[model samples]
Target: MKLTEARQQFISNWGAFGTHWGINRTMAQIHALLMISPDALSQDDIMAELNISRGNANMNIRELINWGLVERVIVAGERKEFFSAEKDIWKVVRQIVKERKKRELEPMLQLLDKLENTEGDKKDKHMKAFLDTVGSIKKLSKQADKTLDTMIKAEESWFVGNLLKLFK
Candidate 1:
C-alpha cells in the first residue's frame, strides 16, 4: 500500500485506541498525524489532513499538550504555531501512563480515602461490608499506583526485561 494509505490507517487505529485510554478519537488522530509527520505541523495543516474543523483540531491539540504527549514548536519567521508529538515511543507510553495515573487513579484513591472515613459503628454489617469493599479496592489501587510510579520512573530496558520474565 501507499504511504498515504498506511498513514491514514495508523491514524484511524490510533484514534480508536485512544478512546480506551480516556481520550477522544480526534485527539489520538492528531497525535498520530503529528507522530508520523517529518516536520512540525501548523493547526491548519492538521485540519486539512484530518478533514476536521479548526475548533476540533485546536481543542484536541490543546488536550494532547496537557497530557504531555504533544508539544508546541516555534519556527523562525513563522507566525503560525506548529506542533509535534514526542517521537520516542517509550517516552510516549510513560507519559500516557503518568497522565492517566494522575487523572484517574489519584482521584480514585482520594475518594477511597474519603469513603474509608465514614462515620458509622464498626460492627454494623452494612458498614463492615462497605469498608471491606473499599479497603480491597484501595489496596489494589495503591498497588497499581506504586506499580505505575515504578513504570513511569523505570528505564525501558529494565521494565521490558521484567515484563518479559512474567511470561517466560
Candidate 2:
C-alpha cells in the first residue's frame, strides 16, 4: 500500500482499538498521527489533517497529554504550541498499562476487598458462595496487581527476555 494509505489505515485501526479500551476515537487518531509524523504538529495542522474541528483537536490533544502519551513541544521561534507522541512502543505500552491499572484495576480491587468482608455466616450456602467468589476474585486481582507492578518496574529487555523464556 502507498505510504499515505498505510498511515490512514493505521490511524483508523488505532482509533477503533481505542474505543474497545474506553478511549475516544479522536484522541487515538491524534496519537496515531503524531506517532507517525516526523515532527511535532500544531493544533491547526492536526485539525486540518484529521478533518476535525479546532476545538475537537484541542480537547483530544489535551487529553492525550494528560494521559502522558503525548507531549507539548515549543518551536524555536513559533509561539503556537505543538504536540508529539512518545513513539517508543515499549514506553507507550507501559504508560497505558500504568494508567489503566490505576484507573480500573485498583478501584475494582478496593471494592472486592470491601465485599469480601461483608457480614455473613460462612456456614450458610448463599453466603459461602458469595464469599468464595469474592475471595477467588480478590486473590486473582491481587496477583495481577503485583504482576503489573513488577512489569512496570522491570526493564524492557529483562521483562521481555524472562517472558520469552517462560514460553519456551
Candidate 3:
C-alpha cells in the first residue's frame, strides 16, 4: 500500500484499539498520525488532515501529551506548535501500561488497603462477611499487582517472546 494509505490504516486500527483501552479514539488517531509521519505536524495540519475542529484536535493532543506518547515540537522561525509521537512501539506500550496502572490499579490498591485496616463492629455478622470478602479481594488485588509487575518486567527481557512461543 501507499504510504498515505498505510498511515490512515494505522490510525484507524490504532484508534479502534485505543477505545477498548479507555482512550478516546481521536487521541489515538492523532498519535498514530504523528508516529508515521516523516515530518512533525502543526496542530492546524493535524486538524485539517483529521477533519476535526481546532478544539478537538487540541484537546486530544493535550491528552496524548499527558500520557507521554506525544511531544510538542517547535520548527525554526515558526511560532505555531507541532507535535510528534514516540515512534518506538515497545516504548509506547510501556508508557501505556504505566499510565493504565497509575490510573486504575493504584487507586484500587489504596482502597483495598484502607478497607482492610478499617476497624468496625468486629463481633457483628455483617462486619465478618464484609471483612471476609474484602480480604479475598485484597489478596486478588495483590496477585494482580504481582502479575502486572511480572508482565512489565518481562516485556523488557527476552523471556516474554520465549514464553509466547510456548503458548503458540
Candidate 4:
C-alpha cells in the first residue's frame, strides 16, 4: 500500500481499537496522528489533518495530556501550542496499564470488597453462593492487582526476559 493510505488505515484502526477500550474515536485518531507525525502539531494542524472540529480536537488533546500519553510543546518562534505523543511503545504501554488499573481495576476491586460483605447469614444457600462468587472475584482481582503492580514497576528488559521464560 501507498504510505498515505497505510497511515490512514492505521489511524482508522487505532480509533476503532480505542472505542473498544472506552476512549472516544476522535481522541484515539488524534493520538494516532501524533504518534505518526515527524514533528509536534498545533491544534489547527491536528484539526485540519484529521478533518475534525476545533472543539473536538481541543478536548481530545486535553484528555490525552491528562492520560500522560501526550504533552504540550512550545516552539521557540511560534505562539501556537503544539502537541506530541510519548513515542516509546514501552512507556506508552506502561502508562496505559497504570491508568487502566487505577481507573477500572482499582474501583472494581473496591466494589467487590463491599459486595462480599453484604449483610446475610453465611448458612443461607443464596447468601453463600453470592459470597462465594464475590470472594472468588476479589481473590482474582487481588492477584491481578499485584501482577499489574509488578509489571508497572519492572524494567523492560526484566519484564521481557521473565515473560519469555513463562511462555517457555
- TM-score of every candidate relative to the true structure: 0.98, 0.95, 0.86, 0.95
Candidate with top lDDT is 1
lDDT of 2 by residue, 1-168 (tens): 999999999998999898876679999999999999999999999999899998899899988888899999989999999999998988988888898899999999999989988896879999999999999999999999999998989899999999999999
Q: Could you tell me which 10 consecutive residues in candidate 3 have the lowest summed lDDT?
A: 151-160
Candidate 4 lDDT over residue span 66-141, tens digit each: 9999999989999999999988888988988898999999999999988987997999999999999999999999
What is the RMSD of candidate 3? 2.3
TM-score, model 3 to reference: 0.86
Q: Which stretches of candidate 2 lie over 4 Å from their true place?
A: none
Ranking the candidates on lDDT from highest down gives: 1, 4, 2, 3
- Candidate number with greatest TM-score: 1
Candidate 3: segments with Cα more than 4 A from true spot: 121-125, 150-155, 165-168
Deviation of model 2 at 165, angstroms: 1.7
Ranking by TM-score: 1, 4, 2, 3
Give the Å shift of residue 152 in candidate 2.
1.2
Give Cα distance to truth, residue 65, candidate 2, Å: 1.1
Higher-lDDT candidate of 3 and 4: 4
lDDT values, one for every candidate: 0.97, 0.92, 0.87, 0.93
RMSD of 4: 1.1
Candidate 4's TM-score reads 0.95
